[model samples]
Target: MTPPTGRPLPFPSGASPLPIPSPPALPPHPPLPPGAGGPGARGPGGAGSTGPAPGWRGLPARLARRLNRVPLRARLAALTAAAVALAVAACAVAAWFIVRDQLNERLDESLATYDISPRQLQNQLTACSGGVEVPSPPSPVTVQIVTAEGDSCVGANMIPVRVTDSDLTVAAEGPRAELGPYTPEPGEFRQGTSADGTETMRVLVRPLGGGGALLIAQSTASMEAALDNLVRLLALAAGAGAGVAAVLGLLVARGALAPVHRLTGAIEYLTRTGDLRTRVPVEGDDEVARLSRSFNAMTTALDASRARERDLVADAGHELRTPLTSLRANVDLLLRSERTGRTLPTEQRVRLLDQVKEQLVEMSTLVGDLLELSRPEGERHSTPVKVVPLHSTVEQAVRRARLRGSGITIDTDLGHWYVRSDPAMLERAVLNLLDNAVKFSPPGGRVEVRLRHGELTVRDHGIGIDPADAPHVFERFWRSPSARGLPGSGLGLSIVAQVVRDAGGTVALAPADDGGGGTVATVRLPGWATGGDADAATATGATGVSGAPGLPRATGVPGVLGVPGVPGGERDRRVPDGPVTPIRAVTPARPPQPARRPGPADGRGEGTGDGAAEEPPRS
Candidate 1:
């Protein structure tokens, strides 16, 4: 009875929904083209109306695009030519107007001041009254006489100019009394046509002394001819000038862009050949020369980077080969015993396994060092740098060193110092320095660690480094001949150097200044005494660490030992007379043990191989 719940109740139980009348369908419209609604589209009147014309509106834009396709030198030449042409055309037009004005002024002056004798005028009037032809003047001037009653007469062989009301007025007034030798009589000058309507003339109307007016007229045909000739000459000159300008512009553009052309060629050569040795020749002190010099410097740097890359690869291969070979040999020995049904001694088996583990650890350390060196210099500090307490970082490193070298004694004398740097990186650098000293120290030998102002020194009483080897100790993978037999990857000092350099500090190794038979490593960093403003210092992002009370700040000068702002002289190196609170000596974890020498199980270390006898110290 419910009509299946969702069937619209059977259209309201057979009453049926009233059929909704369908609207009539209209005609369909054709699709419009792309951009039909844009500026070029039809107006509201649809197909019958028009929108703005695109042709003239887009002309300048279209022309600009075409011009852009032209080469730079050609564009420069064209612009120069256009500028010169415009200038020449303007000058020509101005000169033509000036000359026309000058000619017209001369003609008007001569006509206005023309002399006429009274006797000649009387004879002309008598001839005109008797209806006889008046004699013409010697020149081409047309002379006529008009009476106050509007009667006129013309000379024989002369053109009669049309008379107007102004002439009649002049005839009735007689001659003007204001006439002077330098000034023409009062009259009006006008352009008029001959009575026969065949000639154009310049007419001047002047009243005669007795009773009528005289008209003087001249033809303008010769003056027009002269002006036309001048136009032709000026146009020719302008055309010639424009042509010459275009040629000179092309030459100038070619010469000025010569350096740019050479630079482009060098860049192309380098790109095609993958060579960084290509250098552009620089000449003059212009912008182009500076660009060339910059290009040369870039190539030099790239070449050096490539050289360093090659050396690192070769060194890494050499370092990895020894550990891998030893591991393979040991594995094969174990596999051989098992396959041959031979039982190996337990002690020997355990010892070989321990050796394998140690070698793996050594290989792991070498790989980590390689990865660190391979990272981009900019990405060395993965975390934000901050103002770090230098003394605390040194204490942490010394603790680590004591743990590593239990048989050695490390004495620390640290002072309050703060430096802006990545805290972890700075600590790692200090630890490496301590490790170097610890590695070289003999059993029960004391290692003195001291920090004052912003300088840190670590001294060890061991066989001193050879002066010849000191220069190369910080080079990657360089192990001294004497230290080659010890266990090390030879990258410790290299990493220390990189970190210290990035922190805007300096590190160096030299024989003990006290004449002790050991090496002393000194690190100098810049910083101010006291806490100062931590936030301000962090914002400044200075590389050097701060100094202690009563001491001048380290100058932060790379490889420079002198402290800046010290009165009179460089700060003395002695521990300033302050309470020297020496850290209690750390007890040895085990009885003092002699240093281990390299053996077959030790492999040859990361940077030392059987063939690396001449290598420098890993420290």
Candidate 2:
């Protein structure tokens, strides 16, 4: 059954109830007005108003910003003066309070010790009752008597003290007998003004014998005058102390910041003049001195970098002049020929065109070398490094060298060495080395390349480099007098050195150990014997020269492969199309071997071999 509200009633116990549907969902409330529930909106407690922070809350921040505008030295001095003034003020206040308490205690003791004869008290009492004036007391104190009904009597010519309720209470109490000579009757000590209110006084009230109280007061004008003078003196002293402290603080700040001032001046000089040679003078080994040293070091490095840049520009210009001049001259000749309408002979024309082409190629090679060298050392290694098989890179370089120097023979024995480097850059470095060796070799001379134990050496049986020129061979655009006529920009070895260094290696050129009049360029790179793919390839000896097509095989001998005067041509012995083995460490000299005659299969008379090995011409 439904209730009066039109809702269903509960089901009976132990019976299942029918399902009731949910009420329909209500629509969302409308968006709030512009300022409602926003920054300045009033919440229930009115807490969310967008107003400036209270003065006390933001006082420190405002003060700090204002203080920051002041010079550091002035601020420090002012702080010192303020601190001194506060301390002086504190000490002066303490001294004043102590002196005031001591003076008040003495005055209270004198009032307590004061006593009057009974006759004089009765005379004053009779004078009050009879309405007659009483004579003034002998001391500089004011005396009065008060009854329980708050009536008071004062001495003639003396100001009467205003009686408080405490004095009336004392009067209502019956007077007690004196305790002892040293201990006077108890009384309340308080500060009060005279009845006319013109003078401040210290008042003491004590009970009289007959249901009344006696009051004694002393003027505090002298004590107060002394205290005022002390205050003036303390104020003057504090001012003087603050002035001294400010001066001392300023002097200290100036002395401490002297080095900083010098450093700033040096920096300004450098900035204004654009000179990197300026250095700050260093004295002690303090932090400022260390900063000066660091500044000097920075300038020194900048100067060195500037010098290097200047040298590079000068050298580049010098190197570019030769090829540019030749190009200009060749173009001028072609233009003249075209303008004259004179057709040159085919052979001459072809030779001129070929020379022009060669010059262009040389110029392109030089530019590429410059670009490669211009890249920053860090930028060169920014890419992910790959583990390259050093032997394979060397094999590729050898094949290219053979094609370039077809007349010269190149024999190689490369071991399975793997190094982490940019594969293309590594190949370029190796190619440059091989090309250098090929270029310096005689027309029929052999270039021996050996790689083992992470060291690669390329030896050419040509004019050897002099000991003096050895140091400069790797320098940019530096060529020896003997090799200056050769076709090169003199940046080959420099590029090789830079690349090898980037790969954590070293390259050097020296006279061959055999003293056979040749130069051997040795490159020692740090790498592993086998890694990743090279590990598998090395397992089966797949990295040998025989597995690499287009690469000539190396003769197994340690020194120059061919015998000096063998019947069979040395060319056949230098490079045989057979399986090659790893070369042993190169020694200083080769052991003599028995000379043998040419066999039928040797093809000595059949002219199959190139030619016999001739001794290298001595310098």
Candidate 3:
């Protein structure tokens, strides 16, 4: 799953010809995808054998993964929205609780805030004790009290409750709820209830020191109406606050991410122009500025790589001219001779024909190398890399080099070793190294091959390259001034470096620091294996790595090669870093290459990998 990338780049070693490192191993996966294990069924760690260990189990990571699949802009917006909504909701709930408590507490406080005495209440009670009960409004807050004389009640209007003999008896023992200044005394008060059911009686009762009692009542219709209004106002405020907060939050989010919006527009502009040089005009040096800087850096790097690519092509064209010129001349000579009825001696004609064949062969070799150089990037050959024998492959490569070179003695101190790689690719890489050793070695000087573990070092005792030239040695078509007279296409080491990478190995070139100076190229590989099985890769080379190294260890079964050369149709026989992200391209397919300079990244691109730019585990 592709997640939002944070735009941090890991450094790739520059100029040193360092090989790509192998990736870390992955832990085992979980048993049955979630829910595949039935309810109550334990995971492998929990006693079921079908899952990963318990300590490693958790939901947050999985949730992150799930969320990562979401578009970053949308994901961030959702997170912000959810946070704001929860905050506002919590505030609303708290406010509701606070308001409710206040209303209830205020009502209770009013009931406790009275100063009327029991004696005054008794006098008032006595004034009406033997008379018939007066009618009153229903109590907004229920009011009733027990006095020494008997139990009595008042309604909202400071009148009496519906005191039927039975109701009076029942209410004498019960007050529905307490409210107001429940003074025991008959304070300045009024009893009233409008016909429409408003209740306005505030009543309080107190017992005298042992036997006496008093009751008082007042009308509270106005206060009840005021409190009711207050409650409605509070409700309105709560609703308004919540609505305002939600709206404000959304606006705030939009404002905060304004830079991102601007960046988006700039990116669109760049895409339309197909120019990475276009950049967002940065504001303050914030994360957005950092992002802009990173983008610029990336583009600059890409530009440099592009520049290098152009140089490679130009250099290749220049080197190609010679073989092509020779081939054309020979062909013309043969054709012209055929047209002219010149009865040249049979031996002379045979010689001319042989010359044509030799020139054609040379042209073919040059063309092959050119083709290796021309293979495009994003080719779909994501192949698995494995251990390849160093000794044998180099030996075969040494013999191959002999076929192409003259008067070169091959020397070696070697042992069987294997590296993670494709055999065809690894073999080509070694061959390129051998070719370079032969080309630069003094006509009769020895070219030494040393293999230890998975490292192969080739050294020649000839015109050693300059330190300055060493930097550009593996660059396509690069050559040294000291070696101007030497016959070379300047692509051998480039192919060497390219294929080494595909095989998940590193290649380095340096002038022999030893008193006997010459150029030394070293290739280091991973997935080193020991023993007889490695013969398939390295034993074929000269002064071969031979000894009793053990048996080959098994890696997984390799898949079949699809289209071996084309990137789009090429199967996973090249890149070992899993499947390529995009399986297709906008293409004029890879251009045809002249077939001669055959060292590999295909030729390892491990392209140009498993001959040009491919890597070991990464290819």
Candidate 4:
């Protein structure tokens, strides 16, 4: 399920036809139940019994709520339309109000024209001494004015419309002869809406000389009709604009999210192939651009991981084939001897079996080491780094080294120093170094292995790596020319380097210090970074990007002897010839990581069986 986006709804509908949100409920005010003053009187959940409370609950309610997660594009389209609609409505309303007010002002001016300008009204009031300046009198307006209750008043024809009265009250006060009813100011604009429709009339009333009022307003029916028509036209225009805006918003949404669709397709392709070589075209700078950048980074990382995996498997297969071939050959030879006419004596058979057993043991150990390295780094034995006595670990490894090569003599000076390392891995690292030293030393040659100030040096008295071979000396499957006749996988030194480096140590191979006779492998482990005590530390993920062709392709030939095609997998093929030449062969190193601290987020899992049986090489 996708996570939630915390955005407020603009025009929510709680089952309303218009889709406008209902007004917010007024918050509760403090009061209490009748006859209650304490907490116990409160309703359950601290709510008071009043109108039906609102909220969602149960299945139907939740499903209704889920309508809220509609794709953002669609939601945004809806919101845009809503905003445009509101804007247009507001504009139409404002235009109608402005036009209506303008029409009203014009109608008022017409009425005033009929009644009198200050000068005309003044002339007429004083016109009693002049002739009829307004001959035959002007048309009537809604003339109204305040008057003395029983005073006489008049309009133009003859000073005779009774005392002036309010325009609204005049007809109701009495017949056309009543003295007075309503109060109407003479100079003020007299305006009134008609009873039946928007039709109206106006008349001017001016008292010749009396306590009365004068008022006037004209029939404004045409102006009212014009304003109504204008309002309807404005509404139509506003609606048209809203429709156009909606269509444009939809088009914009579709265009803006086009890259998102491309991104989705790219991710699907990579997911299927486990390849990250494809580049997402960089576009204009925006949030989407940043997303593209992040995706590109992820793909690059995956691609690198895939390449490393391919290399690891190829290298591993190259390394494992030798020991396995030797083991198979040695076993077959023992069985063949048994099949011969002479029944092997127990002593001889025992010797052959013993050799088989020893080889088997070595194979088992190598397989175990391979498995350790191949498992996800999460599974690698982890221990907090702490101070550990270096002398004990060196002494133990040296002892094992001496036992591994009965014909090689070793010399060593064990010295005390502290280091931060997992004891078991450190010991294994030291052992691998010593074993490599013995292999390089000629039979009966003296090999020197010493430990001092946390640095262990293993020098041999045999042919060393050529200068040209030094660069890849520590890489997986890399065997040197001088070691062509050796009997071992070229994995020993590589494992040593990884272990040492992982423990914050360094390993390098160079000409020996004394007379520069053989390769001297030196491991410099970090002194303890903390004061905690050291304890025994005990020590592969997604599929390979592509296969390394585990089995050789069929040539379509029927029978081929001594040419069995072996599946290609991970193993170093170039076998180390005696123990002297130290060929470093590694398992795949991890891919680069971000600023992220290590975690189990990689979906790593444990493996079964000797992970070393990853298939052997055919070449």
Candidate 5:
């Protein structure tokens, strides 16, 4: 059932036929008319009518691809060698021409000086009449006389030059006034072959008396041999120069590309080994140096990111284990009781269930915090930044703290302050700070929360932090040694720090001043002086038109928390067990000082001026 060439096999009746395989077909072109092909006429699809259309449009692309196949070092070396060879060749040609012109000028001057008087020639002719042979005038010089009758004379033992029409014309015309043909000039010369045709001569003609001319011929064989020797020497020198230039070019290219090779090797090693700590060495401040610096910076960033990820995973696992273990234990206890067929007492059973529920809630909170902190700085919940009232935010946080800390008295002193930040995140940060204060406060103790301008401070009247443990409070999953028994995942302060930083502010912790027996957590955020509507309002002065709702009119007192009844001379409405500490009405203090930077007395998150995260302890 095999198919024939270029055809499909026949199928039986009611049987499916197999499809034949073929190469892709090009679009059909219109038929070309015979004998219409001519210049500027296009074929089908605008292609040429030649045997096969040329691919000139892709010529540059093809050349680029071919060039890319060559090693960069070899290309650089070859190019340098070619440039040097061109320059050297140009200089060699110029030198050869200069030498040739100088030699020709010297030879012409020497030939012009060789002249013989008619008397000397007559004496030589008379002596030779006795059959006495005379030697030639000189080895390469021939003396000949040309007369008006187109005849020639030669020195003894020298062949006479065959007279030509040029010689007869020169003799008839006499010497030219402008140093024409028969006139001998310093630089004028002519070249002709001797009658014997065995040698070429450079002839100079000098006129004699009675329409006669003397032709002195000098052989040019020696001059031509010298020029040929010079040409050979120049070619040798040029070749040697080209070879030396190639060697030097190769050496220079290698030296120049050494750093690039090192960089390539380092990057390859890093890729193969999955190592982020590798760095390329930098030497000079050139372009390569800048590239090296950038590469080092990239690797450093990768290493830091990897370390952060590792820390997050480890901390998350550690925090999750406790709650999970508690849940499992409680579940096992209930299962055992059921298996034994013993009905546990109602109170004990209720306690076990409650414990399980608490563990579940704790685990859920831990997971949420982990997810929140895992995102990079820009990816926190996409809460839009807006002008928010800081005073109202603090008041709201205080109310929440009051609910959480039942026995503790919370005091608040806030001045009208506004800031541009994500209101939701800012409130969360404030709540965390207040909750932290309430948590650490002793039963029936007072917690002071104050905000003026953009600075906010939360102080608790509990056991303050030890000097040794104050440095790890804001680190992920870091718990104080004394507070390990507390029910916290140790992520609250970390969240607070991150939120404040995202809002372009800083947070720091220190022991309360004047031996106060508690820690003070201060957050400084950049803010507008007024409630964002009135820019002219001072810190102590209140502008009530656009303030947060449900607040009493600000009284004459400066720096007082504008809560109801507290201002306008009313008694404190809601008092707890501790002393009624009146919220300080701060007099117009020098425009709220800029955020205090961390120094020897301050415990910052990252322990640096830039306020990166640090491992400070929490109380």
Candidate 6:
């Protein structure tokens, strides 16, 4: 029962309303009348749509979606087949219509050629009842005569046509007057169905200059037959063509999509095995080849990444083993002594404990350094970089080095320089350089530190690095043969190089100036603005460097290093006899160039951060 005027009545609990059947789906739009809608209602696009929709319209969309779900090979084949079928169908339809029209036109022209003189027609009619000479129009043509009184008579053919008003009018007007108003011109042609209505006929009524008109007609039977044959031939050819097209389309699609198949297989294999080394073969410069190349490049990158990760793991294990083994051995000894109910000497126990502590610290430092080096620049220092003060960073580094190198004397002549760099990374890089210098210096030997403009130089009075073994300083886990016994890892300079490169700078190692015995490390950073003239500041700054034999004054401004009194790059041409600052150009996995006598400073020569001359590595 209804509960309220506007509210529905409630049913019993657990009862449901009757289900309503859905109506059948309808077309997107209703059948439109000709000229009933807008401009879209007619023309080539609207030809088929002018009538009610076909039954297959709804099914085609669903069928098309299903077709699209098929494999790419099948889809390509189908598309090619459809295109060819369409072309063949269009040409067939066009040819059929053209031939039909041409045949009908020839039939009409044939009808026009039939003519009979007015005198000959009258004579033939006069002799018609006597079975005398009757004017024969043509064999397949049927003729009729209309008298002045609208009477009809058969002329030379078996079939006779009903005389319409137009014929009667032509008769009354005497063969010379206009045939009828319906005719376009005098003696113009007309087409009508034959008496039996089985075939088309071309009709022409001409004025005979007498009291009647002559009607000439021809049967279109032959033309119709010819048209029928043409239609059948066109349909057969179209069908055969479409079939061949389907086969060819499949073949072409297969050949064209071969590369795609290979790529798909490669991707599937990669997915199944998690192997990044799988690559699609590339063979040509086509689009498919380009895609293959891109896939190859991606796999190559992934493989390289995996290799680096493996190497890092292996190297890390190797590095940690020494410290871990020592720590374990010492702890085991302590445990052994306790278990035996015997105590080691106090001094020895303290030393053993100290060694363990040192190992722990070293391990901890190594792990920290590894973490720092492992991350990308963004993750290593998440904060955005701003202009940093290089002078202060150097000062801080020097202080840290002082604590590490107690027996070593440190000298500094830092100039005010500003650069765009991560402050923490810059400071760390400087500290690494300082540490390297102090570690290599002889006892009581002086380590000169100088910062002029954006160039920072750290020189140590130790055995100079051999020219032949100089290039591997920046490779991860690489150590110099002479430095392997030292109590440090080889990652310090590598870290320095990574930081400097991130900050858009360069770092180099060379021998002390003028053959001074020791190694010198130099760093060059960009974006520097200072109050002092760059050239003047660098020239005066030379005072900070100990045992620096005076080279000819370089022609460039201060802070620019080259031979003295020589043009830029030309100093490499003339060789000096004395030992000069070792210059090195460091690149990844490449050997360093040894410093030789200063010659022309041609840019082509391998120049290092130090004012040293050398040749580039052979390719």
**Reference-based lDDT, each prediction:** 0.65, 0.65, 0.50, 0.52, 0.62, 0.62
- Candidates in order, TM-scores: namely 0.69, 0.63, 0.53, 0.57, 0.65, 0.69
| Clashes (N, CA, C under 3 Å) per candidate | 10, 0, 90, 54, 10, 24
Candidate 1 segments whose C-alpha is farther than 4 A from its true place: 1-53, 123-138, 144-153, 159-187, 190-200, 207-213, 374-396, 399-411, 416-424, 438-447, 460-490, 501-504, 508-520, 525-569, 572-619
Candidate 4 residue-wise lDDT, 566-588, digit = tens: 35732112212121121232222
Which runs of model 5 end up more than 4 angstroms from their true locations? 1-67, 119-134, 141-220, 284-286, 335-341, 376-382, 406-409, 439-446, 460-475, 478-487, 510-518, 532-619
lDDT of 3 by residue, 1-619 (tens): 1111121211111111111111122346767776455655575544446666666688779888998897555555566656655675676567666765675445445644644443433333333333333343343444333322233322223344322233223333433322324443333222433223345454444332222222333446555565667656665665566556656665766766677877787778777986766666667888987887777777678768878878866766776677678767877777787799766678887887776666565556556766765665323134344455567777777766666666788888887765545566567767667766675555577888988655577888765554444456676666655454455566666667666554434567665655676656666554334544344433433111111122122232121121224557532242232221211111122232222222221111111111211111111
lDDT of 1 by residue, 510-536 (tens): 666455667677787654345664445
At residue 513, candidate 4 shows an lDDT of 39
1-619: candidate 6 lDDT, tens digit per residue: 1111111111112222211111122236778676765755564355336644567467878997988789887777777777877898898888878887776666656655655454554444444433355445446776665555554555444455545567657766743543233232434567655554556776677665455566667766777777788778877877787778778888988899999999999999999998998989898899999999999999999998898788778877887898999999999999999999799999999999998888887787677667767887456444355556788888987887788779999999998876545677677778777777776666788999987656788887766665655566776666655455555666677778877766555677766555576777778664334534333534453221112222112223223322322456232122232222323336323234344332232111111121001111111
Instruction: State candidate 3's TM-score.
Output: 0.53
**lDDT of each residue in 459-493, candidate 5, tens digit only:** 87666655444556777777664565555667888
Error of 4 at 403 (Å): 5.3
lDDT score, candidate 5, position 21: 19
Give candidate 4's error at residue 410 in angstroms.
6.0
TM-score of 2: 0.63
Worst 10 contiguous positions by lDDT, candidate 4: 536-545
Q: Worst lDDT window (10 residues) for model 3? A: 601-610
Q: Residue 579 error for model 2, in Å?
A: 39
